[model samples]
Target: MPTLKINDVEVKVEPGTLLLDACAQAGFPVPSYCYHPTLTPVATCRMCVVEIKGQPKLATSCTTLAADGQEVFTESPAVKDGRAGVMEFLLINHPLDCPICDQAGECKLQDYSYQYGQDDSRMVEPKRRYRYEDLGAKIVIDKNRCIHCTRCVRFTKEISGTYELTVANRGSNLEVTTYAGRSMDENPLAGNVVDLCPVGALTSRDFRFNKRVWYLKPVPTINRHSPMANPMWADVDKNRVWRFRPRPQGTQVSTHYMFDEERLAWHRYDLDPAVRVATPVLRGAPASVEAVAAALREGATAVVGQGTFGCDSAQRLGDLASAPELRYGSGDRVVQIQFPALQLSSDGVLNRRGFSERGYRFGHLDELLAKVKGGEVRSVILLHDEAFSSRAEAAKLREIVEAAPFSLVLEPIPGELSGLATATLPVTTFLEEADFVIDHEGVLKRYQKALQAPKGVKTVAAWAKELAAATQAAHA
Candidate 1:
């Protein structure tokens, strides 16, 4: 262990820790654009500079390892002047187009500049300009706004194993681009570059110009698309999901940035007003939420809680059934073998463990129906969404569901299962609900709703609570 003082505060960390990280541990985060925990540390950006005792010149905190008794000053006048000079240089050739830039609100240049940048620029020369070029249908490159951080270039080579991006030319003419004339479309993880870009250099084609960053709100939630079940920041507005970004859990274990598929999965939740079941419905007739809940309780002698739901929702929904054993687990069966080293888990259901923990039996739907036929099970409460299952799995699920004496379906959006259900309730989509996550390993992570549910719908937790109160009264 080594003890170091950063800006008058002393903190103990393991030997060889970076001064920039030590300063952050001491409660002062130096501005950095080129440093990422997952990639090799490159202090080329000159953003994370700090004043260390006995050092003649300001040092790059990212690459400089803290030694025992090392006293570092991150707020000294000299350090501030150096940082300002670096910022000025970086912005000399940069375009002042934050409004049109896709990274507007979450852009590092915007945030760091506000915290440690001059309000005015002194550059008198004409700024360099380059027309935006399509890297692929997935990502676009605006070379003029690039800061030469090389994070995206390294990401393609190291993380994605695509090696599609590289630095061409040198000095003032240096530009990050694809190899020769290759496009990034072949790469499954291409969208991650947009996130790796410190500025507006790389942008997502799906997200650009669709909605301004500030207008969208970020909701913390688990990625149902990955095997590790990585947490993400799902940006949304008015119940429409905008985008998904990696919401890292500190710097300890690296949470690899999400892949292109995970990032673009936002479109699955873009609920169309016409397609969405705005309110509760029973056999094609409009009904109140209360009426749906009542019918579900009356019909469901058994319950099926899908693993796709969050932990709190799973617990509450599990309580709606006759007994814990009556709770069945169902999801679209998935078989994915091309496991990219990234968080690309083909499991599809992020909260499988949570449902299983509460006694929801998966692969036991046949037995559940037998119990139903024997009159041991009367009602079935289903927590379902259609995105994860294939056609065969769907058919099996449909058969089992139809066999139940009483069937109630809860869907974030209406699907075929909901159509055949005796009663259908509008349940909260992942973007529209606040709850906790239980990953494959049963690790619990909390998340909050990003958008408001449409008119008459409510979250599964809310519906289950109402059902439980009524069930107890009826039993009495």
Candidate 2:
């Protein structure tokens, strides 16, 4: 450990920790555009300069390591002047179109300019201009607002390993662009570059000009499409999710970025609560939860819960089975791309470990099917979502449901098996409920409710409790 004084406050950090990070630990954060925890520290922005007691020149805190007994001043006169100078040069050719820019409210250049920049510019020459260029169907590049931080270029090279973006030309004409004007559509993680941009130079094609950043409130959530179940923010307005972004956790580099599929997965959950299925259906007609529960309790019942659901959902679904061993697991989707840096597992089932720990047996669907057809298990209760299941796995589940004499399907979204069941109950989606899950590393991650469920819709846990009580009362 090394003890350092940042802005007159003493702090201790592990060895090899960056001075910029140490300063942040001490509550005096030195801002920088090119210094991301996940990316290499380029120090090209020159915005994180700090004055060292014995150093002759102001040192870049991003590249400097903290040392014992070191005294660093982040807000000294010399450091302030240097930052103001850097801010001035960065704005020399930058456009003043913040009103129309997508990054207006969250742009670093705008914040730093108001804090450390001069009100007037020294250069009278007209600002350099270039028409916005589309980097394929995913991103749009506006060179006029660029600050030349090279963060996007480094992201493609280091994190995604796509090497699709690069910096072209010299000092005054430096521009970030794709190689040979190639499109970024082939890059599975291309949308992350837009997040790395400190200015409005890079914008997502899907989200640009759609809505202002300030109007949307970020709701903490998790990526259901990811195997790691990475945390994310669902930017919602008026109960509609507009977009998703990586929610970084502590110093873990993998949490700083996500796959494009995960980034855009929120669209699948953006259902119209007004039009969503709000009531239980029995034999293709409207019915009550009691009716569905009565039909399911006719004989011995077996439960098959997909591993993509929350731990609370799994616990309640397991209780529907006649015995503990009657609980089965489902879901067999696998992610093809294996980005070793970010993805922890290739299996797409997010909460398989959580379900397995709750006495839910996986990879035994065939055995369960045999028991259902042999008149041992007369009824089946399935808690499923089709998005996380493969066609083959879905076919197997459909067979199991159809073989049972009385089957009750519970789903947030209606699927093929839901149509085959004797009865179906509409449940609230994960976004509309609050629950937690255990990841591959046994880490308990909790997600809060981001949307309001419809009037008649309920969570799996809530529905399961009602069904259990109704069935017990009927027996009594």
Candidate 3:
């Protein structure tokens, strides 16, 4: 451990700890642009320069390691001037597009400029400009707004290892672009560059100009599309999710970036109100919860829960089954990606561990189907997500539903399985329900409700609890 004094405060940190981190731990977070914890520190931005007690000049705190008995000043006049100078240099070629830039509210450049930049520019020369270039179908590069921090360039080369992006030209005319004619569409992690950009240089084609960031409230959530169940922020507005962005969990590298497919899956949650099943139904006609509960209680019940749902839902749904052995897990969607380092598992089921912990067995759907056909199971209750189900699984599940005397399905969106059910209940989607899951790494992650569920729509846990109560009353 090394003891260091930051702004008259003494702190002890590990020998290899960066001065920037030590300062942060000492309650003085130095401003930075190109210093992501997961990435190698390039110290190109110079925004985190600090005055050392014995050094002749200010040092970039991000690249400097703390030494025993070292003294550093982050708020001194010299450090302030250094940061302001860097801000001025960065803004020299950077255009004034904050009024229309998508990164306005949350951009590091905007925040740093307000805190460290001069009121006016000293450069009398005309600012450089270039027409926006489309890197691929997924990303667009606006050269005018670029500060040349090269965060995106480094991300593509170092983190993603795609090497599709590069810095073209030199110094004053430097630009980040694709190789020759190759586009970034092939890169599954292309959307992350937009997040790495400190300014409005890189933008997502899907999310560009769709909504102002200030109006969107970020709700902490997890990405169910990935087996890792990576932490994320669901940017919601007017009770609708607009986008999903990586919400880094501490210094965990896996949570720092997400696949582009998972990033765009927010559209699935922006469901149409007319298409959603808002109430319980019996044989395609609207019915009451009590009637559906009555139907469930009359037969030998079993549950087939999709492993992508939360553990609480899985546990509650398991109780609805006539026997503990009747609880089955069904989700066979696997995401095949070239980069295995970024994806923890090819298995797309996010909550397989959660379901397994709740005694829901996977890969036994065939046995369950056979039992249903043999007249051992008289009724089936299925908890499903259409996105996670394959055609084969759907077909097998549909066969079981049809063979059973009665079937009850709890689905967020009506699909083939729901259509075959003798009784159907509307369940809240992940974005509309608060629950937790054990991810691929055995880490428990909780997600909060980001959007409001439709009237009469409830979570699987709530519905199952109600159904259990109804069954008990009927037996009494």
Which candidate, 1 or 2, has the higher lDDT? 2
Weakest lDDT window of 10 consecutive positions for candidate 2: 126-135
Which lDDT values do the candidates have, in the order given? 0.79, 0.90, 0.89
* Residues 1-476, model 1: lDDT tens digits: 99988888989998878888888888998899999887888898998999988989999999999899999999999999998888888989988899788889889998888878899989898987765556878888899999999999888777777788899888888888778778999887788888888898988888889888888878777776765678788887776788898888775333657767777888887877666676667767987656665665654367777777788888888887766678778875463644355544557677778888888888887887678777676667778777776777678668766876667788886789987887777777877777877876667877777777777678988878877776666667
> Model 2 TM-score?
0.97
- The sequence of per-residue lDDT tens digits that candidate 2 reaches over residues 110-164 is 8989999998999899888875666888888888888888999999899888888
Clashes of each: 8, 0, 0
Q: Which stretches of candidate 1 lie over 4 Å from their true place?
A: 114-122, 252-256, 273-275, 287-300, 332-341, 344-346, 372-378, 468-476
Cα displacement (angstroms), candidate 3, residue 46, comes to 1.2
Instruction: List model 3 lDDT by residue over 1-476, tens digit each.
Output: 89989999999998899999999999999999889887889888888899999999999999999999999999999998899999899888787788988889989988988998899999889998886666889988888887766788788888889888787888777777778767889888999999998888888999999999999999999998988899899999998899999998778777899889889998888998777878889987998888988887776888999999999999999999899899999999998866766777888998998999888999999999889888888899999988998999988988888999999988886788887889988899999999999988798999999999888889999999999998888889
For candidate 3, what is the lDDT? 0.89
Give me the runs in candidate 2 sitting further than 4 Å from their true place. Answer: none
